[model samples]
Target: MSRFTTACIVGGLAAASAFASTPAQAGYYILRWDNTGICQVWSEAFTFKPIRWPSGYKIVSRPVPTFNEAVNLQVRLRRQGRCTL
Candidate 1:
């Protein structure tokens, strides 16, 4: 094979790999503490895991795409008297 052919193959592979590898999720979750009934917007992408998280909190909403959206939902929940201080 010629040097030019090898370079083309290498470049193509690099581009393919770059496209195939996706970044981590940027979703957010809304959590409400059982003890306090206070809601919060969790920024971590992962869902509720008892082993990973402390007790007394439960996931109230599905994963939201942005932090602002999550906070809006939280505020709505509070207005409905679901999340109290």
Candidate 2:
């Protein structure tokens, strides 16, 4: 094949690979409140900004790759005393 045609094919493959390999966006989060055993919240938002909570209520924010993982982590955190249910 001509050099120009070969170059175009290579460049096109590179571009396609780059686009296909784009990283996933942040989407899963687990929110747990301190002092309340088994109190937890799940979110799909990229950011967590809690505005208010009862006194002594601590917010534990965990970013996870999947919803199931986030829920499992919340359970673990509750067991570990990092956050309540």
Q: State TM-scores per candidate.
A: 0.61, 0.44
- Tens digits of per-residue lDDT, candidate 2, 8-63, equal 99999999999999977555666545445444655556365664456244446656
What local lDDT does model 2 show for residue 54?
66
Q: What is the C-alpha RMSD of each candidate to the true structure, in Å?
A: 4.0, 5.5
Say which candidate scores most in TM-score: 1
| Candidate 1 accuracy as TM-score | 0.61
Residue 54, model 1: Cα distance from true site in angstroms: 7.6
TM-score of 2: 0.44
lDDT string, candidate 1, 1-85, tens digits? 9999999999999999998897766888888888778888887755545442455788999988888899899999999998994
Q: Which residue segments of model 1 deviate by more than 4 Å?
A: 1-24, 46-55
- Pairs of residues at least 3 apart in sequence or in different chains that clash in candidate 1: none
